[model samples]
Target: MISGLLLLVLVGSAMAQRDLSVDCGSDGWVTVHWRPGLGFSQTLDQSKALLGTCPPSSLMSEDTLLFRVLVRDCGFIQQVMEGRVTYSNMLIYARRPELPIITQLVKCDYDSPVGEESEFSAEEPDENREQETFNMEIMNPDFSGPAPSLRFGLGSSIPIRATVEPRSHRSLRIYMKSCEFATDADIRRATQVHPIIANAGCLMESKSGNSSFLPRRHSDEMRLYLEAFRFALGQKIFLHCDLEACVVRSLNVDRKACHYVPEKRRWTLLDEPSQSYACACCDSTCPRTGLMIDGVSVHKVLGPLVIVENEPESSGSPDSRASSAHGMSASRVWLLVFVVALALVTVMGVLVISYYLCFWRGGRLGYRPSRDLLTKY
Candidate 1:
């Protein structure tokens, strides 16, 4: 027995040594630190830290574990590093803006090589690289100032390029606002019309102060392209020309305001509104009948139309339906009260009967205790 107890104690002691700690700090920006193996740890901020410790002597089940930390918008613009710790390795990840921003890597003094190096050596800096400039006058400039203004269609596709150091990863983002509109009543009368203002094939390439516009084509494809272009132009006019950024691989067009009916069935275009047919049945069978905007037969019995009208002063709006609902709620409340009262009365009746049996009778049914028997007890 003593030997078994000793073995158990040794096993318990071995289990207590496994744990992990994750430390987090922020100066101008956020920094996360991971201590050598405990189990798992994550820190959103120094004040808010998450530390996980496993049971002692637990075998390493998984090598890598993913954790998420949320930071409410902090306006301080900088890259934040998140740290992770495992049994044999420590890892750090960084988060930056969605758009392209300058990133700098600060090497640690005690950094050691992790793997074998390749045979290729880094390239020397190019001294003969020359910059080019273009001087094309704006035809219909919108504004005349230090920065000249040039107009581009709402749906014009522009090419973007970026140069970064070799073996380095960089991201570029551009934001743009697009608008589209159509005024042709025939097109408007169609199932749905998406205006096109600029052809998608139109290409604009830009570099520092040197920009070039590709040749334009007015072919049949270009005519089809105008449909999309007109739509974008209409949306821009509707929004009053909101300025937007042009991000790489990020082209988003906002058309949240446009409302077009679903294309379930085609709508007929009517020439005369007076010639529309009326429902033959009365209020119950067919409540109303009207022509849809596209002149399709719309029977109100199939779907009711909701209308809001101003109330008159004379007819003081007494919501009889609301009052009826309140009455029903009050009836339910009274029913609950009656049920509770009946239950209370039932419990009191049972208690009185029990008291009478225990005190009035000498543990015998329909029998009363005599005075002499009571005196002897």
Candidate 2:
């Protein structure tokens, strides 16, 4: 019995070691490590470490606990290798599928002590008593040129590419917000979100040919790719993007520039303000451009094109032609069966009729002693 128990324990340990899947629903930020020779380089869960999702117990607030890592170079590499590096990373936290409509009484019940009086009123304040203002600012930096119009084929799985040049900044990061409606207000609402579209890292000038800017510049020249699947198919999606140019500091320090505020239940930009060249980079003096970088130029319409297969000229519509072809194939099978049945019936009938006329009737026109000269018996 003890030996059996030991074997079971060993089996359980083996299975546990193989189960490397991440539980994002865990209570805290789960830190995962990946090495080159750990039998596997990286798992899907490890690769998605950048996706910062809050635990169930964590309040859905504007403030999120950010995780950062610092890596030190031990020695110079002796071999050269090629790989594609992703400059832009985004954690898409879509609003919960179903938001519970909690009444003020429910909130008060949760926050207040069991028998204590509340300082704040349980009733909601009148809307006419106070006016709230959301600063609709276009503080985001401008592109060097006009935003390009893009057309994508439906189900193609290709991304839209754009290019922008940042001035007086360490890096330029682009965040996209899309809405079905094309109204300016709807567009304004999209910019307040945290999903990033592209990030052009710090473009600092350096004399060395091996500077990171060279690779970034080359990549920007190549294209700023956006996930095309973000837009719904067969509709004109209004894309409003905000460019946060890291002018005073690098992106590594200003990682909180774009995030959702759980307390307010709204998206906000923290840590840094959007860049504006005309205002000397002052947030107070600068007028927010309603998240429009190039005025109307920043807005774009993406139409998902439908791809149709080429069909040969036929006597009917494409659908009809297909149906006719199918019908013809089915009829041909039936006709071939009918012909085979007729041939089989004909062969059987011939055999039966020949047997009756020759063998049963003795092959004689009149049954008179015929063939007497040829037969010996």
Give each model a TM-score: 0.16, 0.24
Tell me how far the alpha carbon of residue 194 in candidate 2 is from the true structure, in angstroms, after superposition: 13
Task: Report the C-alpha lDDT of model 1 over 48-125, residue by residue, as the tens digit.
Answer: 112111111222233322222211111111111222111111121111212111111111111221122211211232
For each candidate, the alpha-carbon lDDT, in order, equals 0.22, 0.26
Cα lDDT tens digits for candidate 2, 1-377: 00100000111111123212122111212222211112233222222123222112332222232322211111100111122110111122221212211000000001112222222222334456422211111111122332222333322222233334543222333322221222223555443322232212221111111111111232122222222332334444453343332122121211222223335433233323231111121111111212111111134433322222232122123444577689889999999999999999999999999999888876666667658766967
RMSD of 1: 32.6
| Candidate 2 lDDT for residue 248 | 22
Instruction: Give candidate 2's TM-score.
Output: 0.24
